[model samples]
Target: MFASGLCFVGVTGIVRYLGTELPAVQSAFLRFAWGVVFLLPALIGVLRSGMPGLHLRLHLGRGVVHVAAVVCWFYAMARIPVAEVTAIGYLNPVLLTLGTVVFFGERLSLRRVLAIGVALTGALIVLRPGLREVTDGHIAQIFAAVFFAGSYLFAKRLSGIASAGQIVAMLSLVVTLALAPLAAWVWVPVSAEQIAWLAVVAACATGGHYCMSRAFAAAPIAVSQPVVFLQLIWAALLGWVAFGEAVDVFVLLGGAVIVGSVSYITWAEARQRRRVVMPEVL
Candidate 1:
């Protein structure tokens, strides 16, 4: 989890450094392309294994959502402070909880509902929508969170039928296919420095996802979820040291509240799982 957080922070630093010089779509494609290269060994395994049984349509659907989310994220990161982007990204879990209730027919307990509300309050504090005018980056971050949540829901479904390596391979392939045309259309000449940064971003992102997958496999979500809070700290430090961006008090406070809410939700889920599993023993 610590490694995952650090890798993610490094990726964010690279993205912020690149800024909007490259179109968001093109940057996303480049990042994913580099990610695919990093995962070439796994791809080779998938090929040798003759393709893992997977729902192609579902994978493609997830790919679309993920691509959109990545584009929005790039736009947001280019415009906002890295810490702010990281803080705002916490809203993805809130959105994911709502999505599960609405679309997956998952029962929402009062505790979970309260957690969602608290998390939203934290988001509002971070954005301060009415007090200060919201920037396009703020809106983009919110939309990115929503789409990321959608992608995660699809990923959860996919996990039931596919191995982690298979899912990662399919996502890379589908995203490549989906974004290749736009990437070509928006192709702008990039300097060697930009290429190097993009490569670093891709490598870090791949490592981040790899660590995340390993963490999830090692422990239940309840145990692993709290570790994600570390990312905000890493992001803040990276932003400050790398870009001289100051971390605001409100961002820190709101992020803490959001993290607390998510921790409660994780505990609730774990408790619920225990209830279900212990009944057979009883």
Candidate 2:
């Protein structure tokens, strides 16, 4: 998980360095297109083994939403400080909880409600709309979080029916295909240097997802999720040293609040699952 965080920081830093010289859609497309290269073995394995109960529609839907998320993420990273982008992204799990309740018939417990409220408050602190200028970057990242939440919800549904490798591979291919037209629409003359940097972005992102999957498979999410906060810290320091972006205490504070809220909710859910299973065992 720590490695995953570092890889994420690498991705963010490169995107920050790349700036908006390339269009967001084109940049995103290149990343995923390169991602497909790294993940080709997995894709081939799925092709050969053949998934018996594959949900093609769900994969396509997830790819569509994921394209939106990546485009927004790239757009925001180019325009905003890395730390701010990372901090705002912590809203994803909170939004995922809401999505689950609405789409999966999950009960919205009071604990969840309180957690969501606190998470939103944390977001407000980070944005502080009235206190500071909320740029298009901020709005773009928020929308990215929403789309990412939707993507995760799709993953949740697909998890029961698909292997993690299959899901990841399918997502890469589908997203690459979906992004093609959009990328072409706004495409500009990308230099070789830009392509190389985007290739780095792709490698880091793919490695990060792999590390995250291994971490989760090795330990419970409640144990691994907390380590994610380190990404915000790393992003802050990286932005400060690399880009000379000022480190905002409020961003760290708000990020902590959001991480704490999410962690508490995760713990609560884990405990609830144990309770349900204990009765069945008894």
Candidate 3:
């Protein structure tokens, strides 16, 4: 997952660079569009073998929410510092944990309750509400995190019925189709250079997900989860070097707390899963 996290840093850099040149909606659309294009061959094969998963509507619904989330994310990237964007993104997993209890009827343990509380505290530290006026970008990122939490909740629902690759392929196809109209409506002509940049974006996204899947397969979530913190560090470095942005100490401290909470959540989850499976093993 370390490599995956690094690849995502590259994705953030490209989106931030193009954020100035392209409309956020269009830029978000192009990234997923190219991702779909690159995955077409594999997707075609998956389809040829007979669509593997049930609940066609569920997959499409995920795509719709993902489109909104990604559009919001692109807008935030354009206006906010990358570190701030990364810091705010740490909320997604926490929100996702809460979402399960609310939407899916999953029980929230004491550990989860504490983790959620800490995550919110970390968010407050990061935002420091009265100290700095929360801008549109901050609001957008919050919305994006909520929607992304929803999207991930859907993914978890589908995991029992489908393979990870199948789920991802379906999402890429659906999200691409979902974005096509918006992209067309707001379409502005772009240079081949822009196309090249978006292609790189697609490649990193695709590769990052693939690497993440491999990481998950290779170890328990608790073991691999902390490696994701490297992404924040990388984003900070990229922001400093490429965009001439300064690191915000609050963002760093807040991100560490958020990451710690997320790690605890994942560790707890892994332990729960093992407890559920131990009887079968015996």
Candidate 4:
């Protein structure tokens, strides 16, 4: 998970460096296009598997939702400080928790509800909308978090029936196809340098997903999720050193609060799962 965090931070840094030179849709499209190249083997497997009709539709739906999230994220990363974007992204797990309750009928305990409240408080601290001018970037990131949470809900549903590789490969293929029209509509000429950097983004993002999957397989979420908190710290340092962006204490503090809340929720969930399984073991 540490390696996964670093890889994601690298993606954030590269996207921020790219700035708004390319349209967000086009940039997002290219990143996944390049990612498709890296995931071709998995794609081939998915193709040969002859996925069920419903499953294919779910994959397409997830891809479309993910495109929204990625475009919003790219736009936010270009315009906002990396740390702020990273901090806002912590909202995904919070939203995801709520989504599972609503969509999957998961039991939402009082502790989880309180954690959700605290997470929202952390987001408010980071934004401080009335106090600071809330830019479009901030709004975009919030939308991104919501869309990402939705995408995760899709993934959670798909996970019961599909291999991780199939899900990743299908998302890359489907998102690239979905973004093609939007990207071409607003496409601007991208230099080779920009393409190279976007390729890096693809590599880092793909690598991060791979590392995160391995991390999950290796250990429980309670053990792995906390390590992801380092992503905010790394983003802050990268923004400061690479882009000369001033470190915002509020962003860091809010991010820490969110992470702590998320960690608590993850630990609680793991404990609950263990308890449920223990009776069977006995």
lDDT of 3 by residue, 1-282 (tens): 999998988988988888667877788888888887887887887687765345587898899999999989999999998988998999999999899899989998899999999999999998999998999999999999999999999899989877777788888888888888988898898889898898999999888988998998999889998887888899998999999999888888898899999998899888888898886644
Q: Output the better candidate (1/4) by TM-score.
A: 4
Residue 27, candidate 2: alpha-carbon lDDT: 95
The local distance difference test score of model 3 is 0.88
> Of the candidates numbered 1 and 2, which has the greater TM-score value?
2
**Between 1 and 4, whose lDDT is larger?**
4
Worst 10 residues of 1 by lDDT: 46-55
Model 2 C-alpha lDDT per residue in residues 1-282, reported as the tens digit of each score? 999999999999999999988999999999999989999988999878865545888898899999999999999999999999999999999999999999999999999999999999999989999999999999999999999999999999999999888899999999999999999999899899999999999999988988998999999898899999999999999999999999999999999999999999998899889888885544
Summarize candidate 4's per-residue lDDT along 50-164 as a digit string, tens digits. Answer: 8999899899999989999999999999999999999999999999999999999999999999999999999999999799999999999999999999999999999999888
Candidate 3 residue runs with Cα over 4 Å from true position? 49-54, 272-282
Pairs of residues at least 3 apart in sequence or in different chains that clash in candidate 3: none
Q: Please, what's the RMSD in Å of model 2?
A: 1.7
How far does residue 152 in candidate 3 sit from its true spot (Å)? 1.1
Instruction: Give each model's whole-structure lDDT.
Output: 0.88, 0.94, 0.88, 0.94
Clashing pairs in 1: none
